[model samples]
Target: MVSTAAFLRRAFACAAFALVSAAHADLKVGIDLSSTGPAAVIGITSKNAIQMWPATIAGQKAQYIVLDDGTDPGKAVANIRKLIDEDHVDVIVGPNITPAALAALDPVAASQTPMITLIGSASVVEPQEGKRVWAFKMAQTDGAMADVMTRYMANHGVKTVAFIGFADSYGDSWLNEFKRFAELRHIRLVATERFNRNDASVTGQVLKLIAAKPDAVLVAGAGTPAALPQRTLVERGFKGPIYQTHGIATPEFIRLGGKEVEGTLFPTQPVVVARTLPADHPAKKAALAFVTAYEDKYGPGSVTQFAGDAAGVYPRLEDAVARALKKAQPGTVQFRVALREELEHAHELVVPNGVVNTSAKDHVGLDQRASVMGAIRGGKFVFISE
Candidate 1:
């Protein structure tokens, strides 16, 4: 039989160890983004925003492991596996390119980890079933942006349009969404073309578009590469109005296209034109706050829509983590599940990008309020009323 004093000591030691374990619980977040290669412009800004996140969340120490996927889908899958299997991260964020995000779905679902992707396509989270149930998106969907763009085109008397987008998932989503919205607005798509993101020349595509003689042209590519088609069109003297998608809102697009993209119109989130937004806009204050914070740290004119999307992740995690803590401690499968469930309950939660109101059926909680018609005038993205 053990002595009474020895039993008391053992009980005290066990209690102390449990207390220490609870105090040291950490919330691990794994981030994989294309910090190099074709989508570097989008990924770099997102990385900047992630760097600004606090070291702690919901009273627990936070650990962030960032990996660069180099804009490659296979690399993204490897990164996701490493983060989940090796690091045992509770949540994963990023792989901002659509193909990479799509490729990462299997690993996240298999491990039951939650992912919040920054890509513009909605296919990663839509249909909200199976593997997609574990995925969520930060950027506004292509369909929503297409809706606003088509509405603007209709109001401006653009009856016919030409389409030239990348030969990738991003372009595929844009093409389908634009088709649906354009059809509803009674706008005819006269010419359709596809080009690789790294292609040096799109002269053949531009020549075809010119031959069609559409009233307007829509370039549905993203980042600096998207400038190729528009610049070629301008060089070829296709004078009709040219529209772009939300994907090309970066400063690099302007620098690359120069005079060619001067009057380009596109649908973008309020953060892209925060200063130009009206006072009554729901996202104005949040957008301005993020712009100021981001530009102050990175320098003037450094903020981008991608950075806004990444920064929004902080508030999203904050809201969900606070509630999730009630269910389980961080670093556990239960904690991850609780966080995912709480994310879907976000209601009117304002962030730098826009207000989010998630639900079981809608992982991306933004609506019309998040989108605005923007035009590049005087080398700046300015808001334009439809």
Candidate 2:
């Protein structure tokens, strides 16, 4: 039989171990994406990247709970609620569609959870006031991409351009940003039109655009749906240069557009053309690492800009979690707040797509270094210029 003093010492040691274990509880990440609807191409690639993340982050085991939003805002909101209310996730990631990401804002903000979005639109995190303070974005903003695209057009003598985009928030953001940048570059906007993502024909829009006889045409849509307008333009015999936004950086866009998209140019993250990025480019090594790893698993030329954005989330979390662990244990309100604060303080943190330097004011922190002009050539995305 043990003496009373020895028994007391054993009990104290067990209690100490229990306390330590509680402090290092598993970190939970909830992911919601449009994995089965219109944005499936984008969401699938993002999911692929998320799959490659290690089982642990910053010395704590991580549990990832993924949900499909079906590219619907209602579904996204539902999924976010489930993640927050039921799962009690520490952080939320995704909802790659613009509207979906916007819809998720309330749930995350209400729960004081940090969200790292993979969507291209900046509106989700911009004006960093109100509920947006808890949100961050991994993709480069349309404004930044527009700046590069318009500059390229100016250099190439694209004096006048026609705009055809989605009939949704995604298109609205692109049109606003592109218009602002184009005007600054003296590129006249001759015509503007919009079409639904699921629409089978953009012939009417294409006819209006062709009638304008602009020097070039810019299609501001995402995923495979973006191909409809470009294909219609080519079919209708509008031969001037055609431009697309970074939203079309997936291989599905090229596959769907076929030869019609062969000469299409756009501004995209470095990872879309990782192998072709200049040796000294800041994101080249990181981009290549992602490309190699992703292609190794999913097959060559399978990676997309969405995948690159998702892959970057790991490094951001790793950086933030390391700091947050000191403040509070995972699975608690304090830990989520600490994670959000640390994420805001990111400085020169390099990810697969670009160098991030987020602040309280600017949540989507990317510069010219994050974008490169790319053209579809011989069925592949090739770097045109920085």
Candidate 3:
């Protein structure tokens, strides 16, 4: 015959075991990336960061399902559909390059799935609500990059600039933002040119840019492909200062461009220069923490801005996941919806790159504090104090 106290204890133990088992149910996270095409360099770093994600989120087991989009928009859309329809991922991240992220917008919006894009396009999450309610961006927008670049130019006495970028939306977005800022600063746009990322040579474009006789040249492309224009410019003896966007911050770009890319200036997040940042900087603590953890696993000097962006998704999802878990169980549509709502309300959250204070009106939620100017020195990125 069991005593009453002993019977009660056994019953409570069984209930606790059941609850723990239920909590262990997988929280699926889907990631789509450009792992094998023009954007591979960017995608690979992002994938590396994703692989390092914590096994648990909001105290529940997590399952991350990754897919390669091949840097194609059609394939990216297909992957997003599969992740939602088949895998039933609670949340989605990635499509690193801008074009793919733009193409994925419709599918993600239609499915009402929240997607965190790694591209540098404000159009990905504009107007805060309505069409883009389900979308968020991890990377800094082109407009933000333009702001800092223009300010640097104004202070550095660059009165005229020539522009060369990819002949796609990425380039178009940069041109639009740069033009907007340049006009306000009274900077003359000497020449504008476009080229395909896979172009064998940019001799013709470089010649035209040189003839413009601008004080500086801005290359508005990303990844390894962005090196082509600068190299051609060097070969053609264009002696003007050459500037690049944050797109070409990876080691591959530096290796490919070699000495030609030396001294190239660009704007980037604080993570790119974590160690050099002041101890009291808002993102310094978080930035160093990520760098330490990532380098400990992947070896020193392997981290990139793209990887930092990928790592950013975890904290962005953390608060949302914790709040959503109270309303609905993971793996359910209701939980995903609740998570989206919570993400929009995330405030005063610090990450490796910046202090994220997301709101319905601002998804990226970063100001000038998020970025610092950097230059390539001896094949490494060095901070350039303003």
What shift in Å separates residue 187 of candidate 3 from its native position after superposition? Answer: 1.2
lDDT tens string, model 3, 62-180? 77788999988889989999989987888889889777887887877777788889988788788676658888988888888898988899999999999999998999999999999
| RMSD in angstroms between candidate 2 and the native structure over all alpha carbons | 9.4
Question: For candidate 1, which ten residues in a row score worst on lDDT?
Answer: 11-20
- The C-alpha stretches of model 3 lying farther than 4 A from their native spots are 1-25
Every candidate's lDDT: 0.87, 0.88, 0.82
| Better lDDT candidate (2, 3) | 2
The CA lDDT at 367 in model 1 is 89
lDDT comparison, 1 vs 3, better candidate: 1
Q: Could you give candidate 2's per-residue lDDT for residues 274-354 as a string of tens digits?
A: 998899988787787778777877898999999999988887888789999999998899999999999988788777788
Candidate 3 has an lDDT of: 0.82
The total number of steric clashes, by the backbone 3 Å criterion, in model 1 comes to: 0
TM-score of each: 0.93, 0.93, 0.92
